[model samples]
Target: MKYFFFFLFCLLIGIISLTAQSLHFGYDISGNQELRILQYDDDSQSIPLPLNPEPVIIIPVPDGPIMYTATNGLEIYPNPVETELIIKWDTQIANLLVKIELSAYNAKLIEEVKFRASDQKAVLSMSQRPSGVYYVKIYCSDGRIINHSIIKK
Candidate 1:
């Protein structure tokens, strides 16, 4: 009787595990397996506070909205500029005329570059600039504008 109960318990456990696996993973008619992944919506997009001393910059994926901007297809890098600053955008906005302006903390315009974003990238030379707070303003032909702060070391 003891051995029969043990065997029954083992079988029950096995069936429970198989049921849980089928609930979590799907099998197709052709015997192909597919996993259902959990997805979060745009409103839940946020950066978590860093646990380390180093700062973290969360770059939104192509599907998610860009930070601090309504537009979705732009990328900037190296916030604490050392030599050069690079700005890039999606090809969808490549034909739009883009005006990139760099300014000082006091709202003084420093340098401006106007061109078609078809090139997909803009490189600004900051090697000659003084180390201080600065701003980068990008204006798109679609009437979208984004301003970002850059710290020069």
Candidate 2:
């Protein structure tokens, strides 16, 4: 008789254990899965949160914005000069072809620099030209030209 009662008790214990579930506070033990559960104190169980608010799901891929400008200004530094001069410009140009031509009585090319349309600035090097009166011609890709007279002491 005692042996029959023991067998029934073991069977009941197994059934209870098979029905009970192991839970986690903030995470899930299952691998390769992401679970977000919400618990209510009134109910002694947990339920999954809404997967996504919108019924028709759509996700956007991140992408960068477009950037471009044009150039319309120039700056020549340190008049009454020396061996070298620094040239800068205020530009609102985008993806432009730039050429800086230095000329005197007999025109000679001084320096040339190139910039992408996105870059509106450049630094020119002119350390080798002799001290004399010179002309700087700035040419744009769109057939626009600017000229300036500079003196080197």
Could you estimate the TM-score for every candidate? Answer: 0.51, 0.41
The 10 consecutive residues of candidate 1 with the worst lDDT sum are 61-70
For model 2, residues 5-43, the per-residue Cα lDDT tens digits are: 999999999887666644333444764235567655454
Candidate models: Cα lDDT each: 0.72, 0.58
Runs of candidate 2 with Cα error greater than 4 angstroms are 1-71, 94-97, 113-121
- What is residue 34's positional error in candidate 1, in angstroms? 67
Residue 142 in candidate 2, Cα distance off native in Å: 1.7
**Model 1: residues >4 Å from true position, as ranges?**
1-71
Displacement of the residue 12 alpha carbon in candidate 2, Å: 99
Clash count list over all predictions? 0, 10
